[model samples]
Target: MRRSGFLSLVLASALAVPSLACAADHVTGALKGTNGAVHGIVDVTGAPKGVLLRLQVQGLTPGWHGIHFHEKGSCAPPKFTSAGAHVHAATPVVHGLLNADANDAGDLPNLYVAADGTATVELYSTLVSLKGGNNLPALMDADGASVVIHAKPDDYQTQPIGGSGDRVACAVLH
Candidate 1:
């Protein structure tokens, strides 16, 4: 109605646009297992170095579990073979956090579940990219990616999954 009120409204709408755009830069996944499910969210806004991953999972074994981003976004129940291997950016490397040469882009820290079989964790990854920059593999590629939870902890020194046991849970990221 008034010029001052119209200008204020315009300014407020303009300020809200960036936050709305940032919210669109996020991806979500629903991790499912035989017993329970987990909700995963990845925020790629302002990812100058990396992305932020937030996860809330239930019905675990109450111990350490290895987590990674699989190369494919297909999550088949039971085995999850459709999810493929861990994501690699440039070249094939060893699977370990302490490797001297290199580690898989999808390699991540262990997730610990409490006695109640619930875990809420936030993690950051600097290897892969959401916008597909710096020669890194994009999580939103043609094949996409999946977040996988293993049955055992990664020793960070062994080859090919670092002694991580069977795939317990998986969520295809879009």
Candidate 2:
């Protein structure tokens, strides 16, 4: 089978298998840019020990960009600061995916955009949940969470945003 077909089969299986005690197995939403444009779509599913994400987006700068799960689900345009910081525990809250003492569950790897200004990628996080469980924070909590895209790439070892620049696009995980 083609790669896309195979991936569809895999994703279908994943969506069907996991059963969370509360809430649906997954959540999906649209991505909007700071300029108030719809860029793409996002699908988030509850996985065995974590969460799975599949995203397809366009109109980027065609390079590496930082992506993360933010503390708040609000994606107020212009400046996504309303989304708050990374979704992290109250303690052990050091940033950077490469940090030894790292405890920020919202940290994710850099997302690469094609020369055509589009990106299609799958990511998994072993630190969060959909409706909140396993002592991990919930991406779909009372206030909710969001997937934010940055202007620059994440160094993965730097503090905070890793110089990822501005928050360009956001998708609230409702």
Candidate 3:
């Protein structure tokens, strides 16, 4: 009986090792925006199945900021406002919203900025990464799409941009 128990323990350990290795392979990088810079990192361990994204913005004014996945990963300014609205993968009709609907694929919840001009955000979406296409645009595509922070909050549902005005900052997810 003791030997059998020992074998089971060994099997459990063996199964756990691979999971830990995969978790370690999670990739990360920096996300640059217009007014300043922010820390953007992604852990794709269970990507397409599970994903973890974290962002921290510094030197930004305190307020509610709109965050979304844009159609291009290029951050070339004039603010890159021409990156063309939030990511919306819905068929037949494309709209943008932070709530569930046929809205923008990039319409995520608001990222609150602290009074000291710092914003920290962490998001886990079932949708795949920029390249996964499980609804998200390819971040590494040729002229890949970008993740943008807007000067206003996504009004949840409005029309043509959800009234999420002013592209404040942008980051190219390469």
Candidate 4:
């Protein structure tokens, strides 16, 4: 019985070795608005399925807002257009996450802020990765990427940002 127990322990240790070798990578960035205020922080970590995101934000109008991963890491103030469009793979992707013919990899659920203008949430997406792998767009690619928070909520089925309106906050993750 002791020998059997030792063998089991050794087998378990061997199995854990591969997972340790493929440790999850991580990246983080500070979220800012057009006013240049550091209103929040965004932390991203790699996962076996994809990536996980944690956001803690404040100082907003206090309602539902659209959030997504953009194609570039640049976040010019006034308007975050410098961050570019949503991240996508080699194949052309449509805008809406709920659309039958579309569902871009960058589309994520809307974020909600309280009346006091504060929000803390964690989101996970299997469509993207922190590093380039399995044909997924790397959030930390050569050009890197940015997380954009829109002024309005995402309808999830509309075209061109789901009518989420202007880019109000951005976090560069290069």
* Model 1 C-alpha lDDT per residue in residues 1-174, reported as the tens digit of each score: 699999999999999999998875677788888454453433333276767778888777889999988899898877888999999865666788888776688889999989998899888888877758877778888998888999999887788888888999888876
lDDT of 1: 0.81
- Candidate 4 has an lDDT of 0.89
- lDDT score at residue 31, model 2, on the 0-100 scale: 91
How many residue pairs in model 1 have overlapping backbones? 0
**Candidate with better TM-score, 1 vs 3:** 1
- Best-to-worst lDDT order: 4, 2, 1, 3
Residue 131 Cα positional deviation in candidate 1, in Å, after optimal superposition: 2.3
Q: TM-scores of all models?
A: 0.91, 0.85, 0.69, 0.84
Predicted structure with the largest TM-score when compared to the true one: 1
lDDT of each: 0.81, 0.88, 0.62, 0.89
For candidate 1, report its TM-score: 0.91
Name the regions of candidate 2 deviating beyond 4 angstroms.
1-23
What count of clashes does model 3 give? 12
Name the regions of candidate 4 deviating beyond 4 angstroms: 1-24
The model with the greater lDDT, 3 or 4, is 4
C-alpha RMSD by candidate, in order: 2.1, 8.2, 4.9, 4.2
